[model samples]
Target: MKKSILLFTTMFCLSLVVFAQQNKEQDESSDTVKTIEKLKYKQQPGLALAASKIFFSDKRYSISGFGEFNFIPVQNNVNPEMGDLELYYSSLYRYATFFGYRLTDKLIWNSEFQIEFLHYKTEESHYEIVIEAFFDYLFKDYLKARVGFYPLTIGYVNNNDEPVMFYSVNRSEVERLIIPSTWIEFGTMFYGNLSPSWSYALGFSQGLNSQKYISGTWIRQGREIRFDLPKSISINPQLNYTGVKNLTLSTSGYYGNSGQGEFIEISGEPVEVKGKINLTSAYAKYDWKNFRFVTVGTYGQLGDTEKLFELTKDENGENGQVLGKEVYGYLMEVGVDILPYLRKGRPIHEKQNFLFDTHEMKLSLFSRFERLNTHNKIEQSLEGLPRVESDMEIWTVGLNFNSRENIVFKANYQHRLNKFNGDQFPRKNIVETGIGFIF
Candidate 1:
């Protein structure tokens, strides 16, 4: 079944590409529509697109953002040794607001601050935090530059992580683990569209803190946020193609040194290691006839792990963990707007008007599968590292109800299987529901 699904996805993608080129003129014209809901950023992510109204209207300043709330009824969760307890039953995941302004026709400034608690830890009280603040200087659709803090576009969620943008109540596991969405850094980016068919982004930003590396998550634990950006830098680059109607394909890459001036004791000697990270990913999304298909594949490499693992060692160096030299994962899902199939009236595709222009409610069903191994390949398993691969596999089935263009309610059941000790261990399950909205 997995093989069949993979084959179908491949064929589906090829078919879309061929059809898009065959009818390029129609798809190309769709780019010029600067409707209040569909203004063009050419090179910005969905968060930027969220301000379409501000960009299209005569107003010079506006406020916008998104909020997500969720409730989880049951979750067996990770293994006991992993020491992860389930968050409480319910919580307001995030309340972020975006502040946008048009400095001039040629320049734009956008900023964002969010109030959020880590899972159900609202008792700790998170302060209002600045998630993003940037100045965009647009010379044309073909050339642009941005300065200050921003996030990368290495994967779908990294670009469009709003609650309503995806079918699942939580972000996909593969994206969260391997690609790590909401991964932001203080940086400078140059981006623009070569044409209506092609867009690209290049960013140089603060690097990670290598000392924080750990097993099971690789470099995901190394991300940091600070008022003073570090000197070590990471570079991220992306290229996108949207020549097909309702179809987008992109490939993005990241490479950087994660040392951040931290020194670790390797062999009883202090050493400043340039623990580098290299990652690349390919993503695709297509919507047609009330059906949407999404897929992403990512591969990554970590440098100086042997020494970095030395940093992760306990004071006695007895139970130190392992970090993989390489890691990879992929995810795939399809969603169908079943409301159209269930209706007694006209078929959505046959309607004379644009399918997306409709304000009617929609009910959708979706299922997704993901496989990842943060410790996929490593030399002789020593300490806590496994001799055989330690990997995770997940399956999720969900429903989404869109009552309006920007509001969504969703629920999903997720099951997890983890492989280690030459055995497959069932890692509980997660059942959750949530609501998401944008303004």
Candidate 2:
């Protein structure tokens, strides 16, 4: 089934490419249209195209791709006494393809599909794909409106390509295991530069719910937690302000109610479970000559309620069934970049040329701290699923070598500590290495 779905997706994309190219040669006298026609035929579909100049052209139409691999060695001690500490492996396949075309010089459309955790083990499958699509209607250089499935504009770390930007092949453990990455869903947004160095986005999207992918035998992703909110919907608003040529500050927030799904209570009566979630974030970044720094912090809240559970009662009303409890959690992180020997012509430094330049050899040292906790509350109406809560922390450090602005190689290590009250899971320590480039 998965293979068939993948095949269909590939065929559909290829058809779009061919159709666009065929239409490009039509007798369109407009230069704007001509430019877009040229772009339609030149988009690079995979990582192999990153070095192709045609894929990076400044025409109104554009296509780009990114790919990265991560490897982690872990020491598990959560249930150490249950057994000897075990060594484990965690890796990530992060990649994305983006395409855009102009409807005029001022009106452009863009779409992107991103893939992550390409090979994480699950009871059903070791790999799964997450998709994000976008359609932007540009009004001008500073403002645009969009409708599609896109990542919520929450944090810088969540939006940027991690592999091409950082030395560590993996995201901070806080970001890795807690705050979901490549997190996207159906929605619409208003985005564009509000002013010079300043921009904003106001969007409303469908919140993630677990029931959508659950089957009779398995819960697809990893764990089967009932996020009982009906396609929990959310509203996100954010603003960015730049006071200097190389520095910008941003802040954003989210509010929504989730409906996990419908279930029956032990009392033989049916009830609906629904709750709310909220999030807020603030971040800043600075680039001064060869020095760079960035930091972001976020807070989130998950709500629980007894009224969200349900049960179907017989005429005599004898208690016979119950459902799982409610759950909630939160997370945050901060990091910085320090380049000591940044040189202009090195290969590593060359990869990031559009974003940075080497006056000297490039060196970066950075670290991040994160935290997350979730609690499940039991109700007499629900049974089987237990009330559980957990606390987790992650610390990371790394050195980045920029051979040029568009190329880099990096190595880093992390120590993760997890404490749980529901189950005796162990703490873990991990190390990672990575290399990336962009032309």
Candidate 3:
């Protein structure tokens, strides 16, 4: 451990030296206003370099972050028979910072730290987390190696989670429930470009633990991302194509055993039950003039659910907590930026690669529809319970405005629908507003 610490310190110091040298070069270039080309960002990893330009104009290593808060001023359950009405919720939800360094032309370090739900009443505190901390070595244009804790590169949000990247006050429900966006793991990965417009990644990591699997949320509770060593091993692979103008197509998958390093008591005796998860997703995104469209479809299957459900029924003593054999999700969205058509606006000036314009504004009107079911299939029937606790369909209409790329203000109306004909559960309607900034 001591040797590891010393090596890290030395590399960090050397990175500072590289930054100083780059700054000197920038000073000598044309500098009424520094553009991206003046300071060398191409030496960093691909996505990290893009995000850095949005977070900082010139300071890449200094602390920079994005924070967003939301408010729900109106909420109601269309039917009163479900239960007592919920007041909805609000908070200073997410504050995340980037600490990235370019150690050398062939190496880089990237990390993100975050705070969630910043609210207190003298007895409660928020949650702190390390979203990602990893190192990458660039050996060639088509291949690179990475190790450390990294988020699974399964979807767009999991890869580019900055607030400015999405128009919703919150992220997509499909991404949250089905894909479990921001899912991180400790592992080694190899990723790189196949061509100027194609990229791919393949990695193996610590897998989920079926011991924690619950009914309504499927494998979400089984992530084992906290203080536990999951014994199972998992692999995720992805391929993406961006050859068409303003269009992107991608496919990704995850396969892993969901059981490891744990035991469950069944019939007053200890037994080891095994399970595994198989998931796949397809995505297509397009832009035509000022209009944007996106759609995604995902399906997943779990093996050995009968044994897992019996264990869940014993531990939780609730049929609603039964295990699921399958889960799936679907999503579609369309939006248009009306600002450019309303008037002629100055595009943010760039020098080949710099993404900065302090005052350029954007306004978009968008709508999204999602349908998901965690318990789409089960091996055994619950003797007494609601059909499924996690069956849900949601749609929302919203308007998002950006004073600049780094600052956003938004308002939206959302309505949720469930199965069971009409009102076995509540159909909730809500109005919300939000503000987010990056610095």
Candidate 4:
């Protein structure tokens, strides 16, 4: 752990040094701002970089930010349904200032330090500050390697941040609360193009226990049970293929295991419980210039051994036994763009004109569905819930307005249903509106 931390520090310092050198070079090359070179951003990551390259010839210093506010008003009966509502937002929200800089042509650093209320609550608190800062090496024109605290590159939505692109003002509620966006952890990764129309990325990241809760105390062979902390690792791989000029398809998968060690007291003696979790997932997506479709599915299981047991003085003593359970889930989404009908405002293939005419606006209608099942004892016990299965289905249909790749406006109506305990949750619905931008 010490060595890893040191290495990260050293790399960060080295990148700073390189950035200074590049700044000096830029100063010597030109005194005043000039039109940006066309291919300067061909090797860059996204629109932010490309836009910054346009404003600041020096890649060493770049500035960018985005802000958004969402409102959800519920109308109907007095008792608010408990299911599917946790995913919806009721008031003010924002993901602002996010900034990044290219230390050198081969290395870049980015951060998504955030400030927002938890579910639009009145109280405020610090969320995660350090988003992602890593050293990337461009091995070839299309291949790259990165290491540091970065979001896992699993699905299309997982890889995209709020500012650059998103199908909705907020991500699918299923993915937002469950999968966690801007979810970063220490890890290493490799990304490159497989062919002209296909690209791929592979990486490994620290894993966490999937159990939702904890019950009685457990010890592992005389030692107190310490919940799993970076004990397991995750494997993520993705493949993207461009089927046509405007259509793209992608598939990705993730597999991991979580490890926890514990110790318990049995009739005056110390006992132990070591739990292991296995998780796996696969997803596919299709993007056509203005329309999109996606499907994702995942499965996980937890296993552990009883190892020891105690009984009353006159009661029969029990031997150690093993306990385990399996859980599974899946999600799907489909949407279409309405901006295609908004009349093409400009020709992208043509030369640059005024700022407003340089890009076009697009709108889309989308829907998403999700489900989860925990049918075994191991799962129920681990989550501190009964052995009852829980599943949720949400339907969202909305319109999104995106203009010049910088500003976005959205409005959507959502209806969600929960299926559990043989009682179908009442259909809950809400209307949401939002605005966001990137620089």
Poorly placed runs, candidate 4 (over 4 Å)? 1-58, 74-89, 120-130, 141-143, 209-230, 243-247, 260-277, 302-329, 340-359, 372-390, 422-427
Candidate 1 lDDT over residue span 212-287, tens digit each: 6656557766766777758588999999999999999999999999877767775678888788899999999999
Model 3 / residue 117 / CA error / Å:
1.3
Stretches of candidate 3 exceeding 4 Å from the true structure: 1-62, 74-89, 118-128, 224-229, 267-269, 310-320, 344-359, 386-388, 420-427
Tens digits of per-residue lDDT, candidate 3, 181-249, equal 757778878888999899888988888767666554577666645445657778999998989998989
TM-score winner between 2 and 3, please give it.
3
Local distance difference test, each candidate: 0.69, 0.49, 0.65, 0.50
TM-score of each: 0.80, 0.66, 0.78, 0.66
lDDT of 2 by residue, 16-38 (tens): 45434523544566543432322
C-alpha lDDT of candidate 2 relative to the true structure: 0.49
Model 3: lowest-lDDT 10 consecutive positions: 79-88
* Clash count per candidate: 0, 56, 0, 11
TM-score of 2: 0.66
Q: Candidate 4: what lDDT? A: 0.50
User: What TM-score does candidate 4 reach?
Assistant: 0.66
Candidate 4's displacement at residue 68, Å, is 2.8
Instruction: Give the least accurate 10-residue stretch of model 4, judged by summed lDDT.
Output: 215-224
